[model samples]
Target: MIEKELPLFPLNLVAYPGEELNLHIFEPRYRQLITECVNNNTTFGVPSYVLSKIEYGTEVRIVKLEKTYDDGRMDVRTVGMGIFKVLDFVSPWPGKLYAGGTVEMIKADHDGDVVLQEELFKLANDLFEWLGMEGLVKFDQKMLTYAIAHKIGLSKEQEYELLKTTSEKKRQEFLINYLKLTIPIVKQMEQAKDRIRQNGHFKHLDALDF
Candidate 1:
């Protein structure tokens, strides 16, 4: 297994590859961590602190440093590079105040069968319409799963499962199954909402012949 040492930033949410995330850094240890990354043009690992553990995560790169407060807080923009599995965790890495660890990078397959992708896109389009979102889905094929994973209704655990998935076809199948189960419910709820909207409207009644 290929492994490397990285700075660890554990958060309560999952970060998927190709998704841009903005963060507000307030803690002292994290502040130091970000400072080092900015100064050295380095990368960090964002392990999701969910399922009561920190094992899987995405490797992240600092895209931009938006702001730095007078007291050391920072606003930074980051993008997920890829996924990684934590192998060893160190509370304080020798001299640093932040955590560090050895992580094995997870290889990802972003391309799936073309037919399967088209099917997924069709369902995704219908889902967007039901939720009142406009525009056709035209994301890069390689990054499709990560791009839309957040927009659909997924719990933290579900998102983590998607992150753990390494095969494109498997991920596509996973999303397709979720959409298949969810679309009908969303459609029914929308219909119910429309019926509720007609509560105050008047209707013409047909006259019965005597």
Candidate 2:
């Protein structure tokens, strides 16, 4: 396990591996942390929210940083790709939402299989059309994968399960199953809506004559 002390950013949402996160640094302490990461060749960890603080998070690398103000406020975008276990943490001194934690990096298989990639792309395209989100499809493999995964409505825990799996083949299989289950439900809902619209009444209501 590769262990390192990393600054933690607690968010209301969970970020899965191979996902992108955008943050605006405004607080003084987070501003300090951002400055440190920018100055040094360093990455930060984001743990899944467990109660108050996150005990498991993803390691995020800074991709872009924009200086917005003379006094240190900035806009930044980071790509989260690695899963890490949080060992310890310190509370924000006061008026800060972020925390710092000791973490151990978890290695994952980066060798994605081409076959699985192609299959996932196909399923993603099918899902996009099924959900009537065809215009949103980017056709880029990575973006498509993430967008479909999110659109299929995986829970935070389920997303964590996907991130922790070290096999690309396994991840691809999991995504396929998820889409299979969710797509039917979405289609059923659409059908029910159509029925309601045709009858001019809620689906649960008995048909009545005017």
**Residue-wise C-alpha lDDT for candidate 2, range 1-210, written one tens digit per residue:** 888877787665666666778898888878877777889968877777744556777889888895568877899888887788788877762344457767888877656667878877776777778778886757566543444566566887777677667676677788888877877887888888877788855357677899
Q: What are the lDDT figures for the candidates, one per model? A: 0.91, 0.73
What does each candidate score in C-alpha RMSD?
Answer: 2.2, 5.4
Provide the TM-score for each candidate, comma-separated: 0.92, 0.77
Clashes of each: 0, 4
lDDT of prediction 2: 0.73
Q: How does model 1 score by TM-score?
A: 0.92
- Where does candidate 2 have its weakest 10-residue lDDT segment? 142-151
- Where is model 1 more than 4 Å wrong at Cα? 136-143, 205-210
